[model samples]
Target chain A: MDIAIIFDNIGIYLEGLQTTAWLVSLSLLLGLVLAIPLAVLRTAKSYAVQAPIRAYIYFFRGTPLLVQMFIVYYGFGQFEVIKTSFVWPLFREAWFCALFTFTLNTGAYTTEILRGAIEATPHGEIEAAKAAGMSRLLMLRRIVLPSAFRRALPQYSNEIIFMLHGSSLASVITLVDITGAARIINSRFYSPYEAFLTAAVFYMTLTFMIVFLVKQLEKRWFAHLQPQKTS
Target chain B: MINLHGYGPSILEGTFLTIAVSLAALALSMLLGILGALGKLSGSLSLRLAAQTYTTIIRGIPDLVLMLLVFFGGQVFINQVAPLLGYEDYIDINPFIAGVSTIGFIFGAYMTETFRGAILAVPRGQIEAAYAYGMRRDQMFRRILMPQMIRHAIPGFGNNWLVLVKTTALVSIIGLDDMVRKASLAAGATRLPFTFYLVVAFNYLVITSISVYLLRWLETRYSAGVIRA
Candidate 1:
């Protein structure tokens, strides 16, 4: 039990923790940004407009992230044209490759969640907004998106936690995140238990915090949905 | 440009291993699911706490971390125990067992929630009716509860199984010769990661789509009695 090594190496682990946080935050922000338009396209009335987005979502959601990462990192490198393209700079680095894959993967799941929330928005609300002479864009900005966001908060939080968990896969692609750090330390010390247990503890604490915050948000947003206590 | 001319045999072998791993893990997950669900629903406080703790901890941790921990830590633990138990040779855990057990352990947490929810959704009236007819507890569970719970659980179980199938890809990191690992090797050897991974993705889609249809058929069969004439 190399317990002392873990305790003394808190500073080293903190750097890994910071990398993990950055990876999760960047991927989630990008994923959410990409998801909105995709979700809107999914709900579009025309089959021609909807088909590509549907395929994107199905491909991303259907496959594992590890495979996706390998394809993006190694697959793109196989193309001489891609290497010479303007986009090669972004795809050249492991971190960017990871970020790109995570964003796309979470984008698929988030699109589904946001689409469900948007569709679930009451028809009456939109009718009222239109009757009030609101423009289509204004109606979307003022009425549709706000309500959809509120409705989607709980499930979106689950997506966030899942993305955080999924980001651990990036370690396999050579990104030095939390799991990667554990692997490096485990190799150095030949002590898998201590290194992995520390990483597990870090993940659990983050998950607990996310769940707690999401619960608080749910209470604030859905207070009206709670049943009244009888005297 | 990408080519996949020479990767057929290796990819096929890997696909077989992936299927075997997924099926083994699925079986183990179902067993754990039933047991964990029963533990949560049991009268004993200790059993309930144990189940809750297992699910919560597994759910909270990342699957990759858990997989690595179990794979490497398991080897270490086994070697230590082997020496203590009078075994002289250091026994290494096989990658397949490690992969399946890790996936099973992680997904067993998910399956517990799915199965437990399905069980609770079974009506109280049905159980009471069974009791009224003087059915023993075992008889009631086997004949009355299990069948109905499976009916309600098939959809959720199907989703979990699909995800588990995809998750077998993670075992590749631990040197398992599953499809993803084989694809990785093929990509390295052939310099055609794109073609091979796209093939792998399509393969997953085919399997998941077939299973989705099968689950739908099972759902329809189970609900036949309740369908309106």
Candidate 2:
């Protein structure tokens, strides 16, 4: 009911918003860049090539994001070797640990999504690519990957939103994302509704924005499959 | 199994508690889902809108945020309303109850969508045929609709269950003595965070793997009479 307190802390929320935006966007971008190759290898003919990737995906998908984050953030520091390693500097920071976990988590999911799309590439399309006498790499880069990306669009959008929401967990590690910002305000004023509700509103707005953008992308990407507009 | 240093029994108890929480929440979610599905598919416009708003808000917000909101906000709201009802004793909202309700309430929105789609998937002609045979509404729903909806619902329901199992970890933040909290406590005491958390992660993996195997078997059982291209 006390809305004025939220307005007074708007600057803190904005800072939190910035942290969330960058965390989600950077991880998503890096995850996608990493996933494309892993997905290709996932659909390979050899079981040896596929088994490791499958294990990676299963581990990430099976565990909770919070547990994964903790494993990276708090768990890794338990080892003397990791503590002595050069990567210790980065591993010690909560922000790096969160981003690293989110990237791997999203990467595993995107790999699976893209693997399905790749496997589902129409029979005739591959035949046509083969007929063109293109190299295996050429056929994949030009034919399989583009269409698979299109097919993966809807699911990718959902993943993006999931990551956005998942980013809220960063608050638990002491990074002041939107949820962290709300927790701060709540402790200060003991006004849970004003604090968390404001955070919820921010999240909802961001979610709708992502949904809108994805809808536009879908429309453009699927234009060829859409019915013809006749005069 | 990593040496637990005497925390094994506590972790085992926490595992059971986690399972209990998820199952309780699952039952609550299923009830709300059926009602919300019926509400969304009902003739009343207000009912449909209410169902829509429920799903939308739940889908948008993070589960942790919602958990905090309900835990803290519910405490303040209940104490304020207690005076009017002649209950003067201070009631601290139990974290277990708060966690269960928040998770159940959130997943209910997902289940609503699943159940709604499942209901729609049941053939219209079959319903009409049941009507023609002069069956009562309740009888027709039981005999004709329920079976078909279950077949369609299994996949979505399975996905929801897997996610819900993992989501029980959030209850630990609300101070519910779940496995995650137990592991963290053991980790702190032993100063071996990796060993404990890795065990916790494997615990989750085992649960999900078993659930997947069972879900596949259920899917096959339900689709026994049907053929796919």
Candidate 3:
């Protein structure tokens, strides 16, 4: 129908795309940084070490991201202590609230994913590390974590995509991400097809890009598992 | 102890509606999944390609954009068609229906993959054996394929169900009075958004935890005779 409207509003969509890219990448980067140590703790032998980490993961994984975002965006302002705190201004901004929530949310999911990968490590590898008399920290750094990261790559790609999609919720809180841009265009022009469909195309392109990148990573990462090619 | 400020019952009602919406969407998704799976597995080229496109596009788009599209775009599309059919009044698509259909349609793609794999997992020899015994297609499917497919499908189906339940929260954006919306309403009135949203989160945790437990039991029940590594 009104396809020209989308072309005319290309600048707005570019801004929205930048916002989305920043939100997703920052949250994903921060989430991975948060997940690594927490996942290590999660696979620990002691129940005491695992309990709090379990609860954090459970809460984040169980609840919807939208609710979590709302809790941070709208919920935090309800507390006087937060209002008086040094980071109160960050909490007041919609962007920070979204980023904060996405990081914690993705962090929980990533921690679980990494924990599974770590636990699924071959038994003999750990035994070999112990036989070589390597310290726990050394063994983990040199062996367990690297393999786990590789094993976690496929699942982590899925998490990254989910985070990208989840970032669309930032639109709900008045941030002009792709969905927000589409919403603005739709409301202004009453052209939902032109607006939201364009948004969908952007999302689809990003999803395929992630999928392609992950495939390339897997081929490189899992080369050892592949059979040798005949010359 | 947390104070609800007498909005506990309202939240409970919202929880029930959330459950209702999820179940409705689940039923719709399963139906579409079965059909899509059958289409994917069908002999016709058009059917296979159609199924492939459906799942691919749905997987690529975010649920919220699709929800907004179907809710807002569906309204526009309906009125545009209605005029040609001699309808004079504007027809507003119900948010509940729009939300449910959009979610169902989206998850159907996922279910298509799950069900197709589950169906493929059913040993081909068993189906051939049934055919050799002079069993009809429907009978063979009901007696052999269904049981094994269910067993194989439980794990994936459970994961999809959990995600679907949580996705129902998006209905609030379209003005459905689900628990999230109810919590926000209560928060607005009392100016204690933290308490209300925390309660909503707790509610979701309860639902998902219970579902997880039940799904585990279902998996065990379905896997009763099967040996595992």
Candidate 4:
């Protein structure tokens, strides 16, 4: 409706978008890095190796991300010992707290997705790789990890979208992401519908882009499932 | 320092409100889910488009943003329209109603997708067979489609329920005295943030674990006829 006002505030919105992108991208990368080894430990034979990973995943997955963020940001701030610790500088900023929580939360879910994919890898494929005289590490690097990555991509894409949406919660902890920017604008202008709708559009566009990219990746990976073309 | 002095009544009161809000939201979400699913699956183009748009937009926006938007915007909208209807005094929307409706609307979008998928997974031939047997549309839906759909929908519905339950915590940001809000208050008052939040987390885990077990029981019961002995 207020086209001129929206265009006038484009710079502010773009800054918000940049922050949103940074939050999602950094969290996702860190989460994936943490998830891979955890997934391996989860499906490993030793109970001692697997137990902690299982507990970590369960605790993070079970609790709401908001509570986790608050505990990390506000709860930790309450303790005198934590304030004086070396980690105090890191925990002092809202951004670090948000990234920490997002990393843990996404790590838990990603580990589960990766574990399922790894377990779903067919036994015959692994056996065949071994028969070809490939080393255990080589087999895992080549055959197992590739297949598991492909298998996990679809669900992992959903996780990415979810994490993107969840990052908005970081706005609560004083991070000026898109949602926070929208809140600021709404409070200033008393036109919440306009501000919120604009913010929603930015989010929707990002989601649509992710969906498109995921579909392209799926088609590339599952090319064998496609009907063959007659020359 | 963490002693429960006057906090006993306040925490109890907050728990009661939390349960009340969750149940009311769940009921409203179910109603919206059914209607949205039907609309999406219907033959009419406009209805399908409308339902699709509703689910997409709601699902894209975070619940926190949506909740805030609805609370603040709804208050202003109500005030604007109230004077025209001859209501003089400013009518403030109850925080409970605002929280419930906002969460319900968001979850309803998710439930729409779940229900739609389940409905589509129902074998079409069975519905055709029922029609051939001179069964009316409603009768066919009641006898053939509904039971099978519910069986398929239970798992997804369970997931939605868990997520919806956790989302109730977001209402605390809007000043609703739900469990999380009460916990924050107690933490501030007693300077025992870790203890109070841990208690809050434990309460959630207890509620969630129990509901999950109950849901599994319902799933097994509904699916009993399908499983071969």
Candidate 5:
């Protein structure tokens, strides 16, 4: 139980932490940017618009993120056309591949989460906005999206934690994330418990912080939804 | 470009293995889930705390880390312990057992939450009515609790099963030679990573599609008497 090994390679762990942070935040940011529109379109009255979005979400949510990562990292390399294309440079890097996979995976899940919240938005709220002569776009911007986002906040927070954990797969593709760092330490020093358990501690700490932040956001944003105090 | 070139059969075999591993893990997790839900609901303070800690820690950590820890670290622990019991060799933890148990243990936390919520969802009035009928514990559980709980639980259970089936792909990381791993082996041999991975992904799609329908039917069947909003 040489506890010094973890502290010995503190810089490597920090680099891994940076990679993990970069992957999770970028992917989550891109995922939300894409998911909001897809979710809105997913609830459209027309079948033509809804069907393709549904398929995209289903395909992504149905498969494992690891397999999706492989498809981007290794599978894309199999094609000569892709290698010759301008995107070849992006596909060649493991970080880009990982970011692409996580972004799409998280997007698929967030679409569903947001879609559920949007559909559950009180009909009376939308009705009152319509009766007030608000335009469709204005009503969506003011009444629908805001409330839907608040409702989706709790579940979406869990999704962020999940993305944080799933970013560990970046290690598999040689991206040197936190889990990747642990793998390096394990192979070098023959200490799985210390290597992986230390990584687990970092991850658990991140999870707690994310949960706390989400809770606070909910507290401030959701005050009106709470029961009112009587005088 | 689209051909498996003799690796097709092996990939199919791996697909079967993947399904077997998922089912085995599902069984183990459900057993652990029931016990965990019971522990959480138990009157004993220690039992509730133990169950609470287990769920929190397991849920907090990533599945990959736990898989690696249980497989590699567990192997090291067993190797150290076995020599004291007169075993002379390094114990190679079977990846199949490692994968199933790791996924089982990880998903058991999820199932615990699902089961606990389901158990709580069963209205108290129904239980009181069962008691008023002078039914025994087993009779009450079978007739009243289990059926109603199943109704509340099916959707969550279905979601977990879908995720569990996908999680089977992670078994390949531990060298379980499941479908995803078989695809990898084929890709390595033929230099056609795209086709092999696409095949496995399609296989997953088919499995999940069928599962969605079957689980939907189960939900409908169980909700025969359930009045819906």
Candidate 6:
């Protein structure tokens, strides 16, 4: 019940909060960027074109992100080839390890989510665009990607929330995220309830905020799906 | 080539423990899921509110935070209560129990949603027919609803199961000596994190593959007559 420790060490918790925010957002942004083209390939009719991305998704989704993080962070360091390479320094930092793994993991989920959305697009819309003289790239840019993204928004928000929670795993690698701050507090004061509960409060607040923002975005972007008003 | 430097058996033992915890947690969550779903679907306002609060809070918090909080904080909470009950010694929360309960509680919230959806997916006419036959609630549930709900729930339940298996890795964080912890121990001794984690990853892949195969078969078996567009 001694809440003063949390208040006194508020700055450390804030630093952790900042790190978690950065981790989730950066990975989500990178994942979204990569998911677009990968999802396009995913919906292709050809197996050869789609197989590799499917394998990538299957591997990432099948395993735990903790193990994946270890494979990248600890696995890469075990190799002298990687250690002597240009990206060795990056592999050596916990933050980079977290970023690399989080990006790949989120990319896999987003690719799948967006692929489902893209595949659900009506065939007539594409045919209509084709008949109107829209080229493949132009039609994808104008009609397909936008609608798929909008349709994917709800699922994507869930994935985003998952990433936010997943970022807590960064603390395992000694990156000072929110969970790291809580661990620090717990060790210093032996008050797990106060330390961890404070971090939980921060997480719950963020989750609700993200949910609210996504709801607003969905209303704005999905208004076209709403019924026409009788004036 | 498997070179664990004499730690393979430990990893195997860890794998068994992983299965143990996953099964235990799965059972606990299913019970909680059914109860929570029933609560949410019931007519009582308090029941619905309680179920909703449980799902919302569990879904919002990180699983790792909850694990730490329950394992460590549960200890403190128990000690605080023990003095009033005339208990003199500190009670340690078993990591297995802690891991299972925490994962079960977290996934219960998720399973509640899936079970609720499945319950709702049961055809209305069938229920009305059962009611007209003067069947009791329990009888109607067993004879009319359970089979159909299971069929409808398989897809979502399959998904939840896969995620649940993967999430068991977190139990290692709380000192459960699960596969991940065993791999890390082996890696620490041999300084070959690559090999151990690769094995762990392969182990997980095998489990997921088997789960996928079995779930697909179950889906096909249950959906014998249902037509798909």
Among these predicted structures, which one has the highest DockQ?
3
Candidate 3 residue-wise lDDT, A96-144, digit = tens: 9999999999999999999999999999999999999999999999999
TM-score of the A-chain for all models: 0.95, 0.98, 0.97, 0.94, 0.97, 0.97
Ranking by lDDT: 3, 2, 6, 5, 1, 4
Per-residue C-alpha lDDT of model 1 across residues A1-231, encoded as one tens digit per residue: 889878877766788899899999999999999998888778889999899999998899888898888889988988999999999999989999999999999999999999999899899999999999999789888999888998899899989899989999988888888898899889989999999999999999999999999889888888886688789
In model 4, residue pairs whose N, Cα or C atoms come closer than 3 Å (at least 3 residues apart or on different chains), thus clashing, are none
lDDT of 4 by residue, B167-221 (tens): 8888888899998899889879987776677767767778788889999999999
| Model 1 local distance difference test score | 0.91
List the global CA lDDT of all models. Answer: 0.91, 0.95, 0.96, 0.88, 0.93, 0.94
lDDT of 6 by residue, B79-150 (tens): 999989999998898999999999999999999999999999999999999999999999999999999999
Interface RMSD of 3: 0.5
Judged by DockQ cut-offs, the docking class of candidate 1 is high
DockQ of each: 0.86, 0.91, 0.94, 0.69, 0.84, 0.88
lDDT of 4 by residue, A1-231 (tens): 466666777777888899999999999999999999889779899999999998888778777888888888878877889999999999999999999999999999999999999999999999999999999789889999899999999899999999999998988988889998888788877777888888888998999999999999888888886688989
Off by over 4 Å in 2: none
What's the C-alpha lDDT at position B9 in model 3?
99
Q: What value does the lDDT take at residue A85 in candidate 5?
A: 100
C-alpha lDDT of candidate 2 relative to the true structure: 0.95
Tell me each candidate's RMSD, in Å, in order: 1.6, 1.1, 1.1, 2.0, 1.6, 1.5
For candidate 4, the lDDT comes to 0.88
Model 5 gets an lDDT of 0.93
Error of 2 at A156 (Å): 0.6
2 or 6, greater by lDDT? 2
Q: Which residue window of length 10 is worst by lDDT in model 1 chain A?
A: A5-14
TM-score of each: 0.97, 0.98, 0.98, 0.95, 0.96, 0.97
Q: Model 3 over residues B1-229: C-alpha lDDT tens digits?
A: 8989999999999999999999999999999999999999999999999999999999899999999999999999999999999999989899999999999999999999999999999999999999999999999999999999999999999999999999999999999999999999999999999999999999999999899999999999999999899
Clashes of each: 0, 0, 0, 0, 0, 0
